[model samples]
Target: MVLELHVWGPAFSLPSIDPKCLAAIAYFSQAVPKDAWVLVASSDPSVSPTNELPALKNGPTWVSQFRNIVDYLRQYSDGAWDLDSNLNALETADNTAFSSFLESRAQPLIDLSLYVSSQNYWQCTSPAYGDLLQWPNQWLLPPRIHSAAKARTAHLGLSALDLDAMEDQRKRDHSAAVAAGKIPANFIQRPRDTVSKLLGRTSHQSQFRLEALTGELFEPLEAMLGGKDYLVTADRPTSLDCLATGYLALALVPELTFPWLRDAMKSKAHSLTAYTQRMRHKCYGTAAVKVADAYPSLSPSPSPSHLPWQTPERARLATVGYTLINSLADNTPILSSIRAQNRLRQAVESSKADLSDVEREALAKHATGMKKDVLVSVAAAVGGVVALLGYMVQTGFFSHEGEEEYEEEEEEYEEEPLEIEVGEAPDAFGVMGL
Candidate 1:
């Protein structure tokens, strides 16, 4: 079967600005059979199911969204490259929670960086759209996409804070330049430009939303990552790892014009940088060279740790706990209902002596049905907890007894680096003759 992925053309010397596009590339690189011919193409809104790029055509079927594309591929391949196959119930829950967190929190920052940031838009993003469109469309579409992106960032509260920060910094810099005799002291600063006024309307907001989001999301991600080879405790790369790798690889590029966003990403725990580099080497070979070329000054040197197919370390209990809590919170209604019912049952049992026969029967009938509900809920909860504990124990989360063996195997598995070549052009469509 022929599988084709449609995405935005690449800009800023990285892959697509859309994180999902990068994600689709990462997923297919590892998931599909090596011999399978999957074409990645650049597409406009007209061809997409939701008028968005990153749509996938699998044989005669069309699928949109990264998650849906993945699901379709899994089903088509009969569960080949199923990243969550080995995850126990708790780990699965943890994966789902973390994925949702990344989507809601980190993804917006990416959109802001690409489309909302003035420098990035003019220099990197708009030109990308221009390259894929014909004449008037080249002129017409970028602004619309930019406007939509800005609207999205505004909705998420990222655009205003960042724009204000940029405007404030620009004013400061201009003042400093004048004080140092860099420009004529008598010369007045230019009035606020259109972009500035557009983006800086809410300048009074005290905190930087992007910084807050970065801290809120990256702190836990960094802690969970630690020194592990992948995001989860799996022996091989998983879908979550693909997503994390794609988002980080694209975000951490030096050429991105959002100074605060770039600095914030760089300030993340060193392991994140390390993991991105490792995944880049493993999943994207020659493509890494192009991305590095975009930011020659900040390009990382090749490291021995870029070896592919090494076993991943088990996740920490702290990471597991965070995942569990987030997952449980996501299911708050079920848990809350269960708790309320339990309390009601306790009250009814304690006050049984004071109840009339009719009241007793009514309470007993309610209790009988609740017992089944409670049993099912309790069973599910207990099973999840027990599976998590079992996984923790199996991985030696609490001890180092078998760590030496894992280390030995890790050493033994190291070999000549395997090269998985991403498309030559940053935009896969260009390579596919789209």
Candidate 2:
């Protein structure tokens, strides 16, 4: 069977927008032969067991994350698929340590640049996510991921970079202040961000902090490379190379409004910059996905010419129902709890919300849309409750809060799953091809 290496769709002229996805691309390019597998831009986290991207599928077997995918491939192929098989025990240990270092240290920096920074997120990264995903998911996933990033990096003491909600509020306040009367350029008390006024986060300090983070990650990596083309060894690439490439390529490549991460990498760490560029080019060169229809003629690009990428399996129908139902179930409670417009803005930033509009008109529309969603969700939930209560009342099938069971009811569950075999799940349920 042809193996499916499912990942997020490409953006910014990169193989995949995600760093982890990039690592998988690099690993597949090096380890898996062109004939054995296909790359898929599924662009839906719901398709995976772990609810993450860069998943590998072989029949019923499903695995995700770069290191896990490496192990899965190696074991399934019975050692033939091993990328680190050439490394000695010591080298392998080093390989493991570096992978950990990359994920833990390098990841937060990427999050900061791509998701946490208000300007970068609003201008570049969020739009990329919107383009990469389909309808409702386009609205759902970006905010969720952005929320996750903010939580992950909260302790880093860079709250200024993360205040997208407050940023919009400040813009509105400043515009109102300006409309009241135009101020002179030389005026010392010009309208400024309230949060920034209180916290006093300067760009110079943010840059300095960013540079320090880059050094912490890149210094060790550069020291290890020591002028070599690849990390861990000079001759060829390893899984470590794939991970580093994934993390560093993302840090360097994406065009961000606040490009401190990219700037720090370029200005401070020359060696790392070169190594990431090299790995990205070698591994993700001219990468294209396979489709049923041909571009120029009716043939998928074959072999090493383009890395073997395939059209992704459509999202299962069950997934769509779950997403819609789940969104209503999840969002309404948060919406109901909110008491004020400021609190509502905070809810969008904190909860599994996605809309982050850069423009004033768009931000207003986004707020209105969010309010509508909340009302719709609340109505649906209330209607369902009313319907259920009516049925219970008519049939006398329910009891009061302190009432005992009407009878001893036997607990039951389906012995069989919704369907067997995860691979054919989309076919069994239904496929939503974009």
Candidate 3:
């Protein structure tokens, strides 16, 4: 059977495509007994005018993965891949048990994707995924990662990759190459060096970097699946593994081109890079899924005892959280505007006269107790300007109206005594009291 796999997203490029993911597709395509075709379809509104899939260069396959437009296509296709659409269908079918089970497995993954999508709309919908996790006795988040951390010492390899030396060397080489009018030592080295320098200089500081926080999030999944071959066959690759492996390869790049992260995980060990490359190929090509002989043993101890216990998953989660917070601090340009609006709203609301006496006293006490806390939290989020602004807004400090109210008395100007109207007292200040 000829198989065609399509990627429905923003754009298409082999390098942009995760090699592992492509490898998995390639593997599956080759594994099929008869000739099979592979294709990519980009649903990005701004698709390049010149894009042409080699496989589909011949003709259309009548197969597609339309994301938001799932319903229209579902009428014709036997199966649709989107989890949201599938869950919606299941809900309609009213197969409560099956729907609940699928939801339990899929919603967390969806929530994680939304969190990492870095778009505002994603966050708006992330909470909805909570409905899938609901149960009478179950907690919102599974304790799988927590328990694994208490039991396992394995690190999720949260250490950032240091490629500064490579970057420094590449820069030096480029400067030399430019001076010498040569191709920069080696032909392949130029692009490799360029990528290294570019990635190394950029910091990983974005909401989407949460995708790399896989260790913690994958704990329940790993526990449920155990250590098993993830593809269709021991020797053949699967689309799911391709996605996973592809994402991992991108996340684990040695150079840190992504700004939301400090760096990537690096090692002098040949086997480590080799393993990554192998995984990449297997997921992206025709290579079969095979367990590496030298997978790292679980660590005996965790890093940073004060943070959290050392489960591979916990470490992963911590690393992701750190990257996200760091990104918010360093990269979020709109944060200041949002914060200013929030502060302004708070000031105006607090000036209202609806407070009960008890509430007012409690608020005062809370304000007193929170002096240090406020300084730290607000300062961190909005900087020293917050304190000044808060004071001015809260107490009417620095306000023009308040300052004008205290204008110097007329005594300073030797105000001329007003001539009273005929038969009227000197205190009469208006033309007519009537």
User: Which of the numbered candidates is closest to the native, going by highest lDDT?
Assistant: 2
Ranking by lDDT: 2, 1, 3
TM-score of each: 0.57, 0.67, 0.26
- Highest TM-score: give the candidate number: 2
Shift in Å, residue 117, candidate 3? 12
Tell me the TM-score of model 2: 0.67
lDDT of 1 at 303: 33
| Cα error, candidate 1, residue 370 (Å) | 42
Q: Which 10 successive residues of model 1 have the least lDDT summed?
A: 304-313
Model 1 lDDT tens row, 38-119: 4343435445544566788766667777787778787877887576678888877877788878778777777777777776
For 1-434, candidate 3 gives per-residue lDDT tens digits of 33333332111112222232233333333333223333332211112222212111123333222111232223433343222232345333432332233334333333222222222112322232232222310232223222322233223221122233444666887878867987645545434333224334553432224334433334332442344443222333333343444343443431322323212223222333344456555433323221110011234432221111111112245544543463354335455444444444453346433468787677666555545454566568776678779887999765687556456544467678899777745655464564
Stretches of model 3 off by over 4 angstroms after superposition = 1-15, 18-34, 38-61, 66-213, 218-227, 231-237, 258-276, 285-434
Q: Write the per-residue lDDT of candidate 2 for residues 394-424, one digit (tens) a residue.
A: 8866555334332222223325456656553
